[model samples]
Target chain A: MAGLTDNANAGAGRTVISVDAMGSDRGPATVVAGIDRSARKNPDIGFILHGPRDELERLVERRKSLRDRCEIRHAPDVVSMEDKPSQVARNGKGTSMWSALESVREGEADVCVSCGNTGALMMLSVLRLRKLPGVNRPAIAVLWPARSEQEFNIMLDVGADIRADENDLLQYALMGASYARNGMEIAHPRVGLLNVGTEEHKGRAELKLAHDLIAENAENANFDFVGFVEGSDIPGDTADVIVTDGFTGNIAIKTGEGTAKLIGALLREAFKFSPLSRLAALLALTSLRRLNKRIDPRRVNGGVFLGLNGTVVKSHGSADATGVSAAVKLAFKLGRSSFSEKLAARVASAVRVPQDDETSADSNGTTK
Target chain B: MAGLTDNANAGAGRTVISVDAMGSDRGPATVVAGIDRSARKNPDIGFILHGPRDELERLVERRKSLRDRCEIRHAPDVVSMEDKPSQVARNGKGTSMWSALESVREGEADVCVSCGNTGALMMLSVLRLRKLPGVNRPAIAVLWPARSEQEFNIMLDVGADIRADENDLLQYALMGASYARNGMEIAHPRVGLLNVGTEEHKGRAELKLAHDLIAENAENANFDFVGFVEGSDIPGDTADVIVTDGFTGNIAIKTGEGTAKLIGALLREAFKFSPLSRLAALLALTSLRRLNKRIDPRRVNGGVFLGLNGTVVKSHGSADATGVSAAVKLAFKLGRSSFSEKLAARVASAVRVPQDDETSADSNGTTK
Candidate 1:
């Protein structure tokens, strides 16, 4: 509750965008470059870069052009990609990452953006920022370009939780669907569970159970649950929201990203191999960019840590300056957006008191 | 097993390649055409078309010049792609697929190839041909041409067993390495386990345990254990052989295939959008083919169900004339080659008997 109030300053104040300056490939420089680029682009947004000072000061002092527009908050720690997610929250004391997270939780910044270790962020945030009343485990949700007359697809739980039961998976779908409705503002977003196959008996027992539970129980009627989606369907403009567990989702995302980049590289090499092909490559560069934009990792940079009380955007820890910038921009937009608040509100409103079918077990029931 | 065996009289007294003449994409005509073309090109290898008399007769009649060189064997039943592997064996009765498999199994034919349903072929063959001793789970090994001295990379157990333990995964690496040694026939094959990261803590519990087990074990000394490989390394000429569980491997293969096609299509459409680009595309078709060949799925058509008591090749269920032809070619090479025999022989030779230390259980007391 206090955490919400702290971050709530985002609505009325200077709109301070919290930068997890401690994270990212090139660290402070990358985040700073992104902030500079974004600040130059958006006049209304103010940024507070969170990290230890010497580098931040050097960065700000070095980039004289950005000094007037940006400010740095000193946090002493930095979480490396290799750092264990579980251990980092404790170890990253006084570090920029910890402070940046604190800034958002403390309401010093309206939004928080991190291109840091995802597991660390989740572990830290879930404990620090706290989970929503009924939410047990949090899930990560991503937005992908789908088709015309539709915005993009929503994918969930990308390496958030290792093991999920049927209930956890369905809850993920509900959270993701609610995210689509509120975050992207898609009305009645079609929901689909990712499966090895469309056949009911195809995947593991967990998937089969999840499918049956979701479909049979009329679990969440807010969105149209659009059944199962095969791996191929992720790229295709079929389902608006795709849901899967951590392992499969992470692999799917990486495979898609790797495969796309590989093809692009091949195309580049192919076109350059011969003079005539070079000519074609030059001619086709524009069209290729358009295609690239559709699948551009940047356009889909901000992955929301769903089921949390507040919005937390986990940018790919290895994201470049531009990618991190996009993530910050998304968080700013999402912070103001009606997605999570509405989802939480709906969840809160739907379960006024404990029913015969209480989702939570024992006397430790949820928001109910 | 007998049902899947090739007819003795049919394949005997002949020096011909048994083609599973069925409804391969582009049909029997293309196969006859490819055979006609290859036969025209190479005088040594003759053709024995196996299918219904009417279709084979029509094909032979259509190519009058090849009628003298090619022979037709009649088998009425057709193995539909959807048919279960068990059903294929039971109902193989007189199908071309059955005839082809039986032909090879019975030693009447040098090798049998069919681009029919991969599962059915795998099931029939693994049941019939049998896995070699010490081969726990048979893997479908594929060799990818790499940009290195070895010139190719081996990926195994693409889609054999759904869930594999450390043993299965490690066996995949061993089988793949052996394949690199003898199938692709590259010596000192470097084996890498595909993972999210190269570190021990990168993958699942099984992967972690597998990594330690492989490192501590002496069997890996026979080949170079190159540690973990991410998806990006796949495009580069990294390791000689990469091993993964069948689920991830299958998904990755499909993802790679689909992404390549997607990118290729995008590049073409982009090129054709402009007049000059169109002209360039027309001239650079060869370069495109060269690129395609490098990532050609067909180049590695026959995926063997390795570790089986016998040899079984699972070709693409939807394979066309060329794909099926390649599968047959692969089967002939694998069946004739001493890859498995050498592996069995080596394992047996090195360890005279199953010493308790030779096959130690992992930390979980589960066999690695």
Candidate 2:
């Protein structure tokens, strides 16, 4: 207890990450271990672990690093993966996810991290933090491993809402660019609208409208609009930011993950096919490990809820310690960089000018 | 010249595949090489090669296998990759793609194979062959490499139309199941509707309606209905046929292809990182080759146009000889099985009953 106070004093200027520890598939132990891993590598990170106080305290007590740097918040109820978003939103008080979000809402923590049900977390986030001003629909932006120099591309609206109009998509482009700038340190992100094809005349009517809107705002928003991009461009070097409605974005990311996993499984099976191959696998261990590390989904586990008043990172529900750590690291990075404020400022400033222009056009009788 | 007569007589009872040779990214030479390869392995397959008379003749003449088993159709105009579907549909009378489809429409060829622009090819197909009876929309069903025992899963509406109503999705299920039965030799295909989540209560309104509709038809259709599959399940063993609108399906497939390609590139980079890795790669060459062969995009390189009056296989536009050969192989398989006739019968029979039931329900004042 004395050591905990001392650790809190030492972590006074560090970023405090609010974490929901009970809902992950692997349980609270993995979350505790993850924060411990993060705390070990980053002295500038502290945690407010939310779960059943007694159970979480014991888990944190076992880890010396976490015992010092972490504070347990008593949240008796848990938000299970099966909990409906609407149900959780209405009666989710005292739950770990709710308490974790409360810390961020009350300005006690910089960013919140959760491995809970995505829909529940999102619904709670919107209810607690609310949408940023001028954002019609908030987006969940995830970093996808790419061939770019940055090695990762930001894509948005991955399930916050299944629908997005022209304006909503434009907001995603702005928010995605901001995420790239703050999270990935890209000063001027190149954004692409995801479509079935790259051609100008292709895709649905709304996409074409969204494409134009995004392109119109690119110069003012300080990002490059690369026009229409296909799903293949999500992992390619074509864009630093990929924007789409949640339905398409969600399917694309899941499809990408499934394909990668299948390939990895097939690769392992190939190596174990015969005695010679097995020997080769041992000899090529370092190389294989490097490749695995490069493409491991755990390395990029967090999906940042963009266009919200406060930052919330939704870690993979099935994430293990490494995945959770990766998510916490992201939260810490975004918190240290003041990502939520910067994002708020960027979105407000960019979104205002477009509205002003549209209003003026309407007054001038030139609006479509 | 003498060999041509011998080839026609020898191929009298064989399946004559109409090929759009000029529209592919690799030109007629690759198409010639591909058909030659198919001809080498499959004696019962012949080609009505469509392209400029002199150019195709020169290419076909170079391949002894093709010269004996191929006939040239002079389609002077070529459908460029950039041509719009609307533009091509209106005035694409003399183009290689149109000429190729004409062969199928006139019953001169069993099926049509093209490495042309997907949108234009689909447009020309619908215009030339028309939609089958009771099919509101046609779908492009592709065989995706999967973890299933069949090593492939059928995913449909991959870009035929961007939108699919509840009924259209049902049509896709019926068509996709037929494809699996005829093409993959699956006696009882399990169909799944693609959604953001698997829960019955999840996804858009139409998907829910579709889920119920598909479930209702499962027993009579002779296929199991696995309701609501997510994008990850596309390549998983969860379902034999995953159904979705063209928009989501296109993005899923493209994203899968992109992710696989990225992984393949990264794997190659990993194996070439160091001297020891290079040495290990040499030792593991056979295993690596086996892995590559298993996941190779070229191995499963055709998108079959379902719900059309005649069979059409759209190969990858950039397909080389091997890829083109794969498409030809798929085309030949479907042709030999009288897949078009069976599919039309299956769809007509299944779709009619549902409509009749709906009409009866409407008359009984029990319709939703």
Q: Which candidate gets the maximum lDDT versus the true structure?
A: 2
Model 1: CAPRI class: acceptable
Off by over 4 Å in 1: A1-16, A39-46, A53-71, A108-110, A133-136, A143-152, A217-221, A317-321, A345-368, B1-18, B37-48, B61-71, B143-152, B213-221, B276-284, B343-368
Q: Where is model 2 more than 4 Å wrong at Cα?
A: A2-11, A66-68, A354-368, B2-11, B62-68, B355-368
Q: Write model 2 residue lDDT over A163-217, tens digit each, in one string.
A: 9999999999999998888898899999999998888988999999998887767
Docking class of 2: high
**Per-residue lDDT of B1-368 in model 1, one digit per residue for the tens?**
22122223333333456667774655667666655654555444555667887767766676544545566778887787778777877878688877766655665555555666777777777777776665667778876545556545677767776677886776676677666666666767777887766666676888887676554433433677778876555544668777787766765665455556556666666667777667766767776787887667666676766775445555565665566666656655554574446666644432332234433333322322
User: What DockQ do the predictions score, one after another?
Assistant: 0.36, 0.84
TM-score of chain A of each: 0.83, 0.93
Put down candidate 2 lDDT per residue, B163-241, tens digits, no spaces. 9999999999999998998888999999999999887888889999988888766765678898899889988999999
Top candidate (TM-score): 2
- Residues A1-368 of candidate 1 have per-residue lDDT tens digits of 22211223333344567788877876678877877777677666666677766767777666544544456776777888778877786676766777777777776666678888877888888877788876767888886544424546777877787567787787787788777766667777777788756767766788888886566433333567667777666655567788887766766666566666655666678778977777766766666676776567776688888776667888877777778778877776766664557767655533343333355335433321
DockQ of 2: 0.84
Error of 2 at A114 (Å): 1.7
